[model samples]
Target: MKVEIWSDVMCPFCYIGKNNFEKALEDLPFKDEIEVEWKSFQLDPTLDPDQTKTTFEYFREKKGFPEAQAKQMIGQVSQMGIKSGIKFNFDKALITNTFSAHKLLHLAKKYKKANEMEEALFIAHFIEGKNVGHIDTLVAIAGSLGINTDEARQVLTSEEFNDEVKNDFSEAGSHGISGVPFFILNGKYSVSGAQPVEFFANALQQTYEETVIPLKNISGGDNSCDADGCSI
Candidate 1:
């Protein structure tokens, strides 16, 4: 009933995976009982904050792909995104370190809006062409979402939630998750990458079959509980 997802703000696939997961949940029979936990994952901790190139140029340089090829890849991803009701201008994205952003996400969890903040940050970076790595810009986005801007500004300047974010990082490492959008369901099964909705649904069903349905068929080991009574 619990799903933990490890993702990065700067990663495009993380956004795509979010869409896929949302779509999958809509069709899940027990959607109302599901709990979603967002874990912190940084794709590039050493990203230079002063880099002025657009996101596509950075990808082109870092990935060694020509500008034309970069644009083509962006076009492909954008088309895929359109199918899922997301619009991403990946070619012109700006890259930066997401550690601080992860810190804010951790802070947002206390307010029970971590999921919204996560999705907002993704949209800010990929769609609106905002510099999500900048604290001031981040505060503005958080404020627009009705989050306390002053508190967010203070947290951005201070070390608050730093350790919590780091703990999520450590947790991901302990789980052997090495990439963004890695998913763990019920702490028993894991599916890596931005998989399709059917893949997640099938994985859940398969886990239930292998782990839950059989137990339901077990004979009278605890008939008292089923009878809603206790023997005194």
Candidate 2:
């Protein structure tokens, strides 16, 4: 079974969703056959990455939320992260556009390190307060993953993988997905938001079983006599 996740690195719930789904996969009976593909979704694509505004400031100015309310929201999300074994430090988080980060993610997917890239990017922005939108920071992150630093930088410096990122966005739009942490299982079953671990486990189990077991064939089989001789 294939699971496709559409999320943004800057979304607090997206990281939490990642943890929850991963926990479910750990216990999945057919985990070895499951393929996970992380796609990109920008919550605010028009935001300027080079702006001096902080995440809290963006919330206050752009979203029109008061400082107290923003802090409360972050606190609540942080509590959710704690349950998922994730440490979120929103106080130090940066506010920047994630388009470049998404492009880099596409590159990581090519090398089969997209999951690692996503996790590292999340930690960098939320916990370490690193500038994930910066090219240098992304190149360093890729290097840590054993990806060729020069090659990664070359991709970042150029317009590489931009179409791939855009394609993911287009696909998300077509799926009517307007939020982060949206998960699609086998392109059939979809679970939105950071649901509990049990929800993910059940979805995984159901998809696997339905795919492996064929539905009853109610159509006619080989011709046979039924109360009379069958005619060709």
Candidate 3:
């Protein structure tokens, strides 16, 4: 079975949903047969990469949320992360465009290191507060996952994987996906937001039931063969 997830690294719920979905897989009977493909979704594609504002500032200005509300909102998300065993340092996060970062993800997908790339990017942005839009930082992250740094730099320096990122965005639009961390299982079941682990597990179960062929008698047999003789 295949699971395609549309998410943005800058989206806090995406990371949380990822962990929750993973936790659900742990208890799933057919977990070994599952394939997860991460898709690109940018929350703000128009953002400037050279911006020096922090996550707090971005939420306050662009989102039109008051400073107190922003802190309270992130505070709630931070508690959720802690419960999921993830540490989020939202205050230190940098506000920058993830177009180039999404491009690297496409490159990573080519080398079968997409998951590693996604994890590293999320950690860098939410925990380590690294500027994911920068080429050097992306190269280092890609290098840590055994990706060729020079190749990564070359890709970043040019318009490589740009179309792939845009295509993902277009696909998301087709699916009516307006938010991040949206999961499509087997292209049949859709689960939105960071739901509980049980919800994902139930979806997996439902998919299995719907897809697995059941054993049934198609015909009646009138004759049988025994060990010593054949009955007619």
Backbone N/Cα/C clashes per model? 1, 0, 0
**RMSD, each candidate, Å?**
12.0, 13.8, 15.3
Off by over 4 Å in 2: 211-232
Model 1 alpha-carbon drift over 4 Å, by segment: 50-52, 208-232
Mind sharing the TM-score for model 2? 0.89
Model 1 lDDT tens row, 1-232:
7788888887776787788888988887878877899999876666776454676566666667688876776676677678768888765577777787898898789889889999999988898878887999889877877889999999999999999989998997887666767777777677666667787677766655565332111111110100111111
lDDT scores in order: 0.74, 0.80, 0.80
Compared with the true structure, what per-residue lDDT tens digits does model 3 show for residues 1-232? 9889888888777888788889989988799999999999887877898665796787777777788987886787788789877999987899799899999999999999898898999999999999999999999999999999999999999999999999999998888777767778787767777766777788777776786443221112212111121122
lDDT of 3: 0.80
lDDT of 1: 0.74
Clashing pairs in 1: 55-93
